[model samples]
Target: MTKPTEIKALVFDVFGTVVDWRSGVAREAAAFLQRHAPHLDAFEFADIWRREYSPAMEEIRSGRRPYVRLDVLHRENLVKVLKRSGITGATDAEIDELNLAWHRLDPWPDSVPALNRLKRRFIIAPLSNGNIRLMVDMAKRAGLPWDAILGAEVVRAYKPSPQVYSETVDILGLAPAELCLVAAHNGDLAAARRLGLSTAFVVRPTEHGPDQKTDLNAQQAWDFVVDDLNELASQLDASID
Candidate 1:
């Protein structure tokens, strides 16, 4: 193992990393469809909606469009997806309600307990691209014990950008080395590492479900690569004390 650094807090990526957004969102969408459009194939529709996520974000990242919240992106794509799948007659109120499904995503089986352990030792918070409202709602819904919530919405920038990470550390009144970025995504860890923050990779192989194709394992030598957050907590506790 690499020599541990003076880490005092661990900020995490929420969607797909801490929570099983793909499966949970798909399940919720399916239930909504079954109740509203019984003849529609909810599973297929869910997959279609998810497939649009990256491209939608890319448009903003590439400067082809202005930045929009994930909720807006999800709703825009949902409308097209529902229409393409021949589902009709849904009212605006119903569509608005459906857009909130992301907020109710379920955490991975080990997430809550692992987070609980980690929280006992260090300041634990979510540093995700999700807006504050979305993060707060999700935390409440999933029983996530976050000490504070930080996100792109608060800083008006997203991950892989040094500003968001730096801002988070500054706000927490900690130096870069005093903070660790715990995420399942290598790209996110790489960004944090570049900005002098310690990194921990917690693998979530099935984050994209059975058809998952990326982030199967840690791609770089992070400060720590533990099996899960619980193990991560143990490792950190042993290292610092």
Candidate 2:
């Protein structure tokens, strides 16, 4: 562990880490289908949308495309998945509203309180790949209490890209060692480690729903491996109710 004195800030990965995107999107997708495609499975729709996530980011990662906001990619992904679902009669306006589901996700049970506890002791913010608007909206909706919103949009790069990690530390006016990257994804942590940042791995075994074979457990002996945000706070000597 990088002793508590070493880390002055904690940056998080959102989506499955801080917010329960699968369940949140499922809830919205279910209502969407009930009114449109009564036969389509809603949770499956959410999973399919999520399945497109990494690959969509890869397009930018590979320079096959320019840096597009995640909001745009999500909307494009929704259109493609809807066609596969075989549900029709949805207007563009309805599509736009549903596309905002990412902005309305609910936080994991301990996210808000744990963040509040951690915030008292360190600068806390999200280092998500989501655009600024997406993270801002989600924080307001999920009550995440982030000190700042940063990541892909700010740096015009996504996670695992050394740019995002390096630039985020720069933006916070902190050295790489002064900020801890707290995430459920080992790959995200690994990337941060390369930049000399501290790392905390919090297990979200069901982050990918059942059968999530990867990131179900820590791959390396990271600086901190706790059960969840609450425990992470406690481990850092932050008071958590």
Model 1, range 1-241, lDDT digits (tens) per residue? 3356477888999887799887777777776788767776655666788888778877876668877787888899999987887778888988888889888889988889989988987899999988888999999989999999887787777676788899999999998988999999999999998888889999888887777789888899888897778888888778877
Looking at model 2, residue 82 earns an lDDT score of 88
Q: List runs of model 1 lying over 4 Å from the truth.
A: 1-5, 35-41
Q: What is the lDDT of candidate 2?
A: 0.90
* Deviation of model 2 at 241, angstroms: 17
lDDT minimum window of 10 residues, candidate 1: 1-10
Per-prediction TM-score: 0.91, 0.96
lDDT of 1 at 94: 82
lDDT tens digits by residue: candidate 2, 1-241 = 5766788999999988899999889988888899998887888889999999999999999899999999999999999998988878999999999999999999989999999999999999999989999999998877889988989999998778899999988899998998999999999999999999999999998877887887888998898998999999898884222
What lDDT is reached at residue 69 by model 2?
95
Clashes of each: 0, 0
lDDT of each: 0.84, 0.90
Error of 1 at 125 (Å): 1.0
**Best-matching candidate per TM-score:** 2
